[model samples]
Target: MLNSAYLCGMQKYKVHGALTAVGMIYGVNYSIAKEVMPHYIQPFGFTLLRVGAATFLFWCYHFIHGGESIDIKKNLPRLLLCAVLGVSANQLFFLAGLNLTSPINAALIMTVTPVLVLLSSALLLKERVTAKKALGIGLGLSGAVLLVLQQGESTAQGGMLGDILIFLNASSYGLYLVLVRPLMQRYKAATIVKWIFLFGFFMVLPFGWEEFSSTSWQTIPPLIWLAIIYVVVFTTFVAYMLNAWTLRYVNSSVVGIYIYLQPIFASFTAVLLQQDQLTPQKLLFSLLIFSGVYLVSRK
Candidate 1:
């Protein structure tokens, strides 16, 4: 029994690691999008294409895997709310923000999401925000502020529109996570994903037509097409599936903590891809955020 319990614990850790890796891949995909998509597609239009592809792939996966087919009558309200919060609002805010802000600034601003999730969970779910968690939130927020300061003149010159949009993006996603936690618990991940994407597809259809008409399908480079495919497959489908699966075994607050790592991963990827400079201040802030998240999520 002791060894069995130990093995179970190890298995859980492995599963969580896999989920984290999936999240990292999603982050990388977003970084790639930041680099490539803007050259060819408008942000909203790009979102429409990626999400549309993701929706189709997820639907086929559900149908083929013998997963529960979406029952609109039973799940309509939940699906609608998810589509609004998770798909429509979240993506719209993010794409709009990315247009207004530098990718680094956007990434830094988004580190606030875990804190927002904690606060929302505390207010809505009565989840206790212990002293350690509070400290963690403070430390993380401080690190984010430090990062903003470190960016200095460039960030200041970039204006606040992007920053505000990114902030909204973070908040919308946090709320979506909190809102979806229960539904995820009640249904298979694929079922929830299927409905969310289906509703999302419809939500964006009217706005996406111009994009569908204007895009030069034959002229798009193969490498860019490959990036789009990667975003659809690994980032949209697999990443969300892993996130939903992990939520079943963890609390929303705990799962929310993983978001703190996104900026670190994003910065690393930026350095590798863009030859961006890394400074001591950036390293320190990253450490502060990671330490804060550890305190907040520690059992």
Candidate 2:
């Protein structure tokens, strides 16, 4: 028989490894999304492809793993909301925003989602937000503003409409995160994802059909297809699973802190692959945001 002490130690190690893998997966997701955005598909088309492909892959995995199927009759309301918030609206707004704004600008706006979540949780869920939490959120917001200011020239060139769309995306995503947790606790992540995708696919179908009919499918290259697959499988499917798994093990506060890393990873990847320059301002703002998140999480 295995010793209790050895089993506990093994479990602890597994949790840590999972958290690390989650972070890395999230980082790669941002990098891959940024890389693939401009190559083969327009943002709206890309979003549709991503949701469709991921929906298929996730369900296939679910069936293969013998996961329980979602009961539509029992969970219709929750499923509908998840589909609207998490899948259709989130993807649609984010892609539309990207078309209007620079990726860096979009990433900077997304950094505020944790703060939004904290506030929403307090208002809607009655979760306690201590003074320290408020301070941390404030600091994080300041850092985000700095990061955006650092990219002022690009933002100005991108125009105001895109910036507004990006902000909407950020707000919608924050609401989705806060609201989805309870449902996640009650349902299997895979089941939640499958239904969300099904709903999202239908939601986007009318619009997607128009775009689909207009495109010449044969002219697209193999590399473009590969990029779409990467975005669909890794970014959407695997990333969501890792995120759901990590949330089960870690506090939401900790998860909020880790999300700040997305922009930093995106910025670095942009510099390395796309030859985008990183200004001193971005570095400073990033530090400020990290410091804020650290402060908020500290007991």
Candidate 3:
């Protein structure tokens, strides 16, 4: 009854849909996650929860569906670098920044990555940078500065501090993407993920331990517990696994496009939920940011 071509098309559609869902989850997570932090948990402490639980889950999944072995000596150093850049430092800064800033700022600032990637490609990979892309990169950076300057209505302790840290986090993450690009060709996604999180757990221990140890879990609300669970299970694990799976059916550009959708999803979700309001400034700066990203991301 089913045509083979139709079946193939459906499978590809579903895979792309899965990647879009990953972006949506990431977008919505900004508001959902900020609610629990510095109230039910500190940023570093929550990072511990995210990395530790996800690490456990990765290992469990690996055991169930065993994969090829990695060369520890050859791979460990690079994987360790990924852990530090991708998993440990990136999460710590993002959550810490999100805690201090509004979800809208956090979400909008993240969309600047395409420009980051283009620049990184040019500098590191020695790829050609056209004038259009150079202008795109300039627009993205200008938008980021504009984004960080807008004051949120209800801020945590250090809004400026959060903005700075988020840029640092974005930089580190951009470099991680570049650094790991080669290894991705050499290893399975799961294999790389397992080692990255495994090493990342240790890298975060010192920064996260005291806050995690001091957390008064008993005083937290059931909703806070649910938020934490969602961070680990849905935001980290499900989003990432779906992204990896999508690679089988789609190229990196498709995956990257889905990431651009996160801020839209986040901004709309926050506005609809009354957690954040749109301003003339926000609208203008956001357009600048996404416009830049569109130019850089376009083929």
Q: For candidate 1, lDDT tens digit of each residue in 90-116?
A: 777787677767766776777778778
Against the true structure, candidate 2 reaches a TM-score of 0.83
Candidate 1 weakest ten by summed lDDT? 1-10
Preferred candidate (TM-score higher): 1 or 2? 1
Off by over 4 Å in 2: 1-39, 69-71, 151-154, 250-254, 277-284, 296-299
> What's the lDDT for residue 174 in model 2?
70
Evaluate candidate 3 by giving its C-alpha RMSD to the native, one decimal: 5.6
Error of 1 at 208 (Å): 2.2
lDDT of 2 by residue, 1-299 (tens): 11112324566456445544554555555556655554456677777777888889888978898777556788788678867877888887877677666666776677777777777777876667778777777777787666655644465666478778877876776776667666666667776777778888889776666655566667777776776677777768987776555444444454555556666666677678865679887888788777876665455
lDDT of 3 by residue, 1-299 (tens): 11112325468568657866887898889878988988889999999989999999988888999977889898777888878888998899999999887776676567666556556756875656667666766775576456545644333444888877787777776666656655665667777787888899998888999999999989998988898999999998788667655544433333443556566567667679886677788678767766765564444
Worst 10 residues of 3 by lDDT: 1-10
Candidates sorted on TM-score, descending: 1, 2, 3
TM-score of each candidate structure, all chains considered together? 0.88, 0.83, 0.78
Clashing pairs in 1: none
Inter-residue clash pairs, candidate 2: none
Which candidate do you rate higher for lDDT, 1 or 2?
A: 1
lDDT of 1 at 294: 68
Q: lDDT score of model 1?
A: 0.74
